[model samples]
Target: MTHDPRTALLSAALDAAARGWHVFPLRPGTKRPALHGADRCRTTGDCAGGHLKWQERATVDPHRITLCWQTSPANIGLATGPSGLVVVDLDVPKNQDNSNSSADTPDGATTFKALCERTGHPVPTTHRVRTASGGHHLYFTAPAGIRLGNTAGTLAPLVDTRAWGGYVVAAGSLTPGGSYETVHDTAPAPLPGWLLELLQPAPARPVVPLRLPAVNGSRAALAALEAECAVVAAAPEKQGNITLNRCTFKVGRFVAWGDLPRHVAENAFQAAGEARGLTAAECRSTIRSALDSSLRKVRPRETA
Candidate 1:
């Protein structure tokens, strides 16, 4: 007995919907969304009031899933945000790349494994999918009230993540390469604490206003410089030098525009970084380097 392709696709959508994942339709045999874009919206149905993107419109209702897949042999698209999933996509190098050393190039799986070993973490076992390109997707449940955005090469080279603004071509989808199949039939594990630490944004630090004596510059420039110095002074522990560099670099644009003098900016940053525990030498070196780079990159004031 042979299974009808349409029926198989419908079953795939329903299965994902059953697991509480919000499901959308991918174009037949591809990972692209089948939904219309905002620009193409006709102000009808779901978009009567405003356009709903694929993530906003993804559904977990079994009735909607059945009705959708019955019309076409569409692939299943799992919206990671709505489903509370954070999927790590481990991908192989593209087949079209003709580099002679391609065979030795580390793929996402290899890099991710090395990262795990270095961090003293075992490769997390979770609900996994083998994608058409022979890559893998490891699904983890996102922590409540935390929304993570998609990342490319942030965790490790070749490793990408799909979260709030992303989706994954789920198991049972097909492409020219092959079919995506469930390699591990299990519930998704909660995202690891260590990984969560890496993904979470740094906590915002409170900046106590800097009271600098009168300086030679526009009032706007003086205020901006003071605020930036306060940010450096309030940087979290062990982050003082990095914060000093960033803040000084921002003020450098004003220097380039002649809104502030370089000496004044440098002097203020030096004082702020020293107050925040950075060595005088470290503060001077970082401030000089940051300003140099910022000045070099800044466009002419008129164009800017």
Candidate 2:
């Protein structure tokens, strides 16, 4: 079978460990190896002599040596698949100000630290450089029974440690914009213990019933209403400009006036009413009155 470079690299590292060798795993972007104490490999198959020696020294605990790949680098090219390794994507935003004076801490680094604290795991001292994008890759040794999986959308598996990827630590997950700060390998502030405790567990809330209005009793009226709604719902996209009412109308699955663009859909109802010999203004006013009545029914009354 043709050799997969990533798999080959991992297999060699594992084999070296089995033979009482200490292996240090590294990634492409950064000068520092993700697994410290080992130097970069010059080629796909070649390991620096120092790294080989370190691997030999680590042979007593073969699990010490691990390969970590960056799966969620902003630039797609350098992202890698999980090879039974523990990959932690530190999704830092590009606009993040790394300067210490800034009031806001880097969301990604803060989140990473939080995860480590919560899990009672020591954070790795080293990080991998991502291609072009400012995100850093951190790899941690996985707790037993977790193996990394394949890439899905923007997410990729880190090494073989499945437990590590796809978790959203509020701090580490990137915002709508790309920017984050590095909390690893620096004199960062301690993560709040209270936040970690709150994350531990919480009670579930009771579910509330959702009530929707019954459709008009007349089949002909219901069909006409449905057709009118369909036309109004398609209007925004058809016109190539979005209005608040159009947006609301589009999101509503049911033909409830409350769910629709009140004024726009009301106008359509008025037009329909006029065509059917009812006064346009009266039809519109009726809908407004119904909406007001429904709103009052749903809301809690003020207590004296």
Candidate 3:
């Protein structure tokens, strides 16, 4: 039986809607939205697949999906965020938008490869769509109260997330390059704990300076840093997060002594804490509390 591509896409659209994903219409045979003539693409970024009012227009209504497909077998796009999806879009930039330049950009697959190596955490198993550009759209359920964004190159250079301001071309959408096909049809998986933390912005970590050590001691400033950080990293997995927090408070005492610059200590300790299983939130809270409470209001001492 020769499968009708348009009919197949329509069926897929209904399936997605039934699963609670808000759906929108993409231009036929394209990954772009089926909107034009002053009612067109006003939003940018990952919204390259949709429009300014894409969210408002997205629907789970069967009547709307049928009407859209009847007009034209428009490619389907799934609106992210509101329905709790955040797609990890892996892009392979083949050419500049304005020019026919075939300059090579870091493709999504390669970036994802690098990320696995750096973080020592593998990408989670999840519902996946293969893009026409040979990229991937790994869908994950968003955590409550956390607003993720379309970030590129920070977590992994070639990776872009389709979140609050973006939409992903649905599995059945046809692009000029090819169709967005499902690699995995199962339920979308929860975002990994580490990844969820990585996606959010780093919180403010301020350190207050206090009086310097009078003798400064036989202990080199860096030696103290090295020792305190070792203690944090060596914390046992059982109650490890608590141990790291207390060690951080001790390190904050060093910051107060001006032996360690706030940024340097925070970065070292954070990297260590993550390696030891502290969530980003846990690490930040500990560091901030330590910085706040560890330093005393004593007067400065004379330098030797």
Candidate 4:
């Protein structure tokens, strides 16, 4: 006897729910509904097949359904639990030359492996979804109790289990290739220890907001310099310099440094740093430190 895909999917979801797993459908292109109950469908159109009912039934133990997906109803689902799932969106860098590639590079798989090792987690089941940009969504789940959104702006690697496809292995939820997965069964792995600490399931300490110093000429100069420093601090492989230069140019225009003398440019840079929260003295000191270290290494072998 042939099994219906919809029935099969619902049964799987219900089974998972029985085992304390939260179930959500993973149909793409369906409108998300406003209903809060698990028995109600959260989408409409071809992707809406029996999802509402599944959700309503699952809601009986809302925290038990891990996730659910329907291909005919257009690929969608729901996530219910104490800690939502973690999703890593991967994209290919524009600068990288991938003209001759057909599958995820070695580096990509290696990165995924490293993340799995770091998180002490195993790769759960995987899925391929039709994405908005005509790309494929590769899904993986981590163990329970893992936090998702806490690593929103982090870069992580992904493994392409598909026979043909590639992905970006950088930080953060926004990837050039596609958006990050919104739900999963387990917490994302290889989560940085610091991030894990921040995402502890307890109420977090209130962060003290720092007050910026008054925006004076000096403060503006300092702010500019601080901005430049931030650019210099980024990874060289990540176009840090270009980004920094763009920010510097924008500051130069804002502070009217374009019409000023060369010395004024320096002052404006310093003032910008101060305006952005760094002290003028600190900005100067950091620049001097970088220069001093560079000079020490390059200066002809000190003539004793």
RMSD of each: 10.7, 18.6, 12.7, 13.3
For candidate 2, write residues 188-216 as lDDT tens digits. 22223432222122233233322223543
> What's the C-alpha lDDT at position 71 in model 1?
94
lDDT of 4 by residue, 1-304 (tens): 8755455444544554454434444433233422344454365642266444433432325333323333342222334222132333333333344576645332333444444545555633344333333333334343345534322112232322211111121111222445433233333333344324322333322333323243335555556555554543342432322333344454444234323233444444444333333333433432333333333333232331
Against the hidden reference, what TM-scores do the models get? 0.67, 0.24, 0.60, 0.33
| Clashing residue pair totals per candidate (backbone < 3 A) | 0, 24, 1, 63
**Cα lDDT over the full model 2:** 0.34
Model 3 misplacement above 4 A: 1-4, 36-52, 96-106, 205-304
**Deviation from native of the Cα of residue 103 in model 3, angstroms:** 9.5
Identify the leading candidate in terms of TM-score: 1
Worst lDDT run of 10 residues, candidate 3, spans 204-213
Tell me which of candidates 3 and 4 scores higher on lDDT. 3
* Two-way TM-score contest, 2 vs 4, winner: 4
Return the candidate ranking by lDDT, descending.
Answer: 1, 3, 4, 2
| Candidate 1 lDDT, 1-304, residue by residue in tens | 8877889889988899899999999999999999999889998998898999999899999888888899999999999999999999999887726765466667889867866765679999999999888889999999998999887664655688899999999888889989999999899999998777656654543445566767778888898898999898888775675688778888899999998889989888988877776655556666876788689879887887
Q: Where does model 2 exceed 4 Å of error?
A: 1-82, 97-105, 118-121, 141-304
Colliding pairs, model 3: 153-157
What is the lDDT, from 0 to 100, of the residue 296 in candidate 4?
39
